[model samples]
Target: MEVETENKYLEPLFQDGSLYQNELKCDISEKISDILTTITVFGSVSIETSQPAIIYKSKKKIQAQILSAIPHHPKSIDTISISLRSKLPFPAISQSSFRGFTVSPSGFIVLSDTSQRLGIMNSCGTYDFIKKGLNSYNDITFVDDITVAASTINAIEIINLDSKLTERVISFHGICYGIRYYNGKLLCSVISKGIQMIQLSNGQITDLVKQREPENWSYLAIHDDKVYQTTSNYFVRCYTMKGEMLWEHILQQSKGVARGITVDNNGIVYIAKYNGNSIALLSPDGQRCRHLQISDTKKPWGLHFNAITNSMTVGCVNGTIELYDISYSH
Candidate 1:
């Protein structure tokens, strides 16, 4: 389901001494608010407030509260597809190198090419490249608006976007292939160790799942509380946080190797079919599958979907990057 909020202004309803003046105002901007939300399976809700809640920015710490709440239903999706916007002029890397990219909530794109360069592009199409003291970056993800975490050969480096410098590094025992940030922690895919969860506050690592044998080039994406992972045997699997297999689907041999995976707001899964030269979108139930037609000739390697803005960014193995506007009918 989709909900759109229009741009408007909120003003004070009365003088400072009014009875409702002391009421808590919620200004938090994250998708997950501080107020606890409880919803049943495949459900949506809308909360209406008596007064407009103003959202403002301030350097000083601000306090707010929510004294009251409200609830909804789900819809059926008929079709899902995308349209090309424009090709992003990212510098080309080797065709055989690892390519990974991610989209921020505010519409910026962060990409990792080979082990030599990292590029950050704004909504205006201009970009900056960072290369000094760079390591072999296999994958990249946003920690927040101003920070990002990059997976290296055997470590994860926390880099500040403003300063473009490495702030901290968390070492690991095995090869780190894919990395993602959720809540306040980082979920990473390690070669033979499977998926590992790392707490950003404290350097604590927990094994969420373990692989039976060593593998190469593992990638994953998270939605709601479920984790989606791609396998080397031409399959995509869904698992719980505790490592329980929920469902698994194998793509046709014509799609080539499944490299990267991401899920949209509606729980629809997307995978980058490397040599097949296309991006595949699967239904939430893992029963229906469809391939997105790409006008480009380069093979698609990395995939990222921004649920808030309904946009997608695709990175190819030959260092080509493209953006698309996504739409779905229910």
Candidate 2:
């Protein structure tokens, strides 16, 4: 017997020209029978009566298609909670002026500072420094599994992690502060130029947002189709990829200046309060907020959350790097 199928063109994953990076979670407790009933158009389940019925019935309760579970979108979550796990020992750097850092999918970290070198390390205390063809590093982001792009005074350099060599350089008229990689493009903050997008393949640059007075201390993060940014004025603004501002929030004067900004797997915004000595968590809708106190340090400058391991990496202005495990509750 042959099964006939029609040729139907599938739509692009992101239909509205927006980038979506929602992580999918599997529910091992879900039974195939339940999945069938839930997916049936009329809410009916047909019995699978065949020669293998008896054998399948014996293991019906057993977990099947565990990896094929439906996606669990955290946007539907009502509340969230966080706690600091044991801090991983980050190797100390002498006379370090930390700027930013990014964590790769495999847990490797690459940190940039205002020095002539970039520090590459992991949570296990393994660390190394790359010091060739570099003047001053400001912000850094991972390009791929074994490559990273770092911004400097007036340019962005792409370097290989394994070889630790500058593969290419993307020059700019002004200083590039914060940088992030998404969907084969680099979103950058160039002083006086606002938010810009770079095409990695052809090096074409396009402006996403026009900044009247672009601040040098601004940072940005992307979640799903939205971009969250923080400015030196302690203002956090959410914008679409086309530069449409959706909502904005200004940190209370007591919370200090917002320096580092990141969005977790659940779409919650986390801002590092540099002088406030705390991390502020903003709800997805930008309506509610809570704080995570930092007793050990007061100058958090960079933040990166790893959804795979449920951990976060914090880089302080004093060159202190710490990894924290985040626990969430509904």
Error of 2 at 208 (Å): 0.5
Worst 10 residues of 1 by lDDT: 1-10
Task: Kindly list the per-residue Cα lDDT of model 2 for residues 163-255, writing each as its tens digit.
Answer: 878889988777877788989999988788888899999999999987856687788898898888887557888989888998888788787
- Model 2: how large is the Cα RMSD against the reference? 14.2
Top of the candidates by TM-score = 2
* Candidate 2: stretches off by over 4 Å: 1-79, 88-96, 132-134
Alpha-carbon shift of residue 145 in model 1 (angstroms): 1.0
Candidate 1 lDDT by residue in tens digits, 146-243: 89998877799998888888999999888887788988888888887888999999989998888854266678899989999886647788888778
TM-score of 2: 0.76
Candidate 1 residue spans exceeding 4 A from truth: 1-78, 92-94
